[model samples]
Target: MNEVQARQAIVDAGTVLYKQGYVVSNDGNISVRISPDTIVVTPTGVSKGDMNPDMMVVMNLDGNVISKGLRGPSSEVKMHLRVYRENPDVTAVVHAHPIYATSFAIAGVPLDKPILSEAMLQVGVVPVAHYAKPGTTDVPDSIAPFVKDYAAVMLSNHGVLTWGSDLEQALARMEVVENYAKVTLVVNQIGSERGLSQDQVDGLAGIRQNMGLSPIVMPKGNAEVINGTDVIPQGN
Candidate 1:
């Protein structure tokens, strides 16, 4: 997409995230790679729901501003930049604090259960990065290990980050993360979980490959029955 299209896409994505309650007042960020070196990103301190195309900031891979918007670039731009730098194929980045997903992040649990077949295919396993201060270099460092293998990762005690070949895929992955987290929470409350078998997971992996998505590792065991109190607490 060109600069104008990228800017509009970011604005549209922000509206979706806001309407879906994935973000609140100035609580999330979005970015789109317009070219190899140019990126259009949401500005900081602005409600995602209230963004316009002209409010998008244009910046280079080095984080140098090509055009300043009405406000500054998102404070977490470094984290978004880290994703693009780590995965050359990623053209869009989304970072948001969806309730269920952020709860999992807060509980220090990785969304690794293979119980949801569609989630396994679309979102893969969302691992948790070690806790790092937000909007800092350390935040980028914490997510580095999982960036190459995963489309999404939960920021420990923070939120969720997703990236894909384009803005639509990236946003879809973010939604999947929250959906998976909600189902997983329900399973925990149900006190029994039936994760997909190794063969089943392998089958899904093959399907994902056919769909041109990167392969993800799934748990290789049978169903699990959790009788303990490992459920994440109910809160954002």
Candidate 2:
């Protein structure tokens, strides 16, 4: 996408994410890799929902400000840069405070168990990275280990970061993570999660490999888990 389109797309994504309740106030940022070295990112301290095209920022892979404006690069830019550095396939990164997913992250809970077919099939297990201070090396470093395995991550006590070859898939993964977290929360309350058997899980993995899919890890459990059975009854 050209610079005009890139900035416009960022503005549009901000509106969409905010509308989805995935971002609040100035709580999230999105970036699109325009090339191997150039990235188009959202500015810090601006309400993503209300962002205009002119508010966007452009930087190099090293986070150097290639262009400046009224807005500044996000403090979380390093974390976004780290993902691009590790995953050459990733072209877009959406980091937001998605409510359900962020709730789990803030609680220091890891979404490590698989209970959905599409989730395991699409993005895989959304690991919970260790808590790190926002806008610091620690945040990106905590996530670096999982960056190669998962397209999306639940940052402990922070928020969600989802990426893909493009923006749609990345944003879709974030939606999936939030949906998965919502279901998992309900199931955990009931005290049980009876997932699919080992053989079935392997089958899913086999299918993934056969399709030549990128390596995305499941939560070391079943593949196609039973629905209500996995939905543990509350207070059980």
Candidate 3:
């Protein structure tokens, strides 16, 4: 997308994230790579819902400001830059604090179960990165291991981070993470959480590969058979 289009898209996406209750106050960040060397990002300290196209900041891949907006870039811009550095194909990055997904992050859990087909296709397993103080270089360092392999990662005690080839896809993946978290929460509350069988998960992986997606690294030994009766209730 051109610079004008990229700026407007960022505003639209920020509005969507706010309206969906994925972010509150000034709690999230969104960015789009407008060129190999530059990105358009949400300004810090503004409610995402209140953002306008003019509020978007432009910065280089090196995190240097190309043009200041109505305000400065988000403090978490380094994490976005890290994703771009790790994977050139990622043109957009979204970070948000959706309740369910953030709850999992706070609890140090990973959304790795292959229970929902759409979740599997859209996001696969969302692993948790090590806890790092928000807005620190540690945030980028924490996620470095998973950026190249996964579309999304849960920041410990923070929120979800998702990336894709474009803003729409990145935003969609964020929604999927929250939805999957909701389902996983309900399953745990119900005392029965049966995952898709190994064959079923493998089939979906095949479909993912056929669609030109990268391989999902499932947790070691997570492919074991899990019948409904075999699950132990995880009390909230």
Prediction 1 TM-score vs. true = 0.92
Q: Can you tell me which runs of candidate 3 are displaced by over 4 Å?
A: 218-236
lDDT (tens digit, per residue) of candidate 1 on 1-236: 99989989999999999999999879999999988888999998999999899988999989999999977797799998888898889999999999999999999999988788888888788999999987789999999888888879999988999999999999999999999999999999999765666777788888999988777655454554432344757678
Residues 11-74 of candidate 3 have per-residue lDDT tens digits of 8998899999999889899999988989999989999999889888999999999899987888
Better of 1 and 2 by lDDT: 1
What's the true lDDT of residue 96 in model 2?
92
- The number of clashing residue pairs in each candidate reads 0, 2, 0
Per-residue lDDT value at 46 in model 2: 91
Off by over 4 Å in 1: 221-236
Give per-model TM-scores.
0.92, 0.88, 0.92
Ranking by TM-score: 1, 3, 2
Off by over 4 Å in 2: 222-236
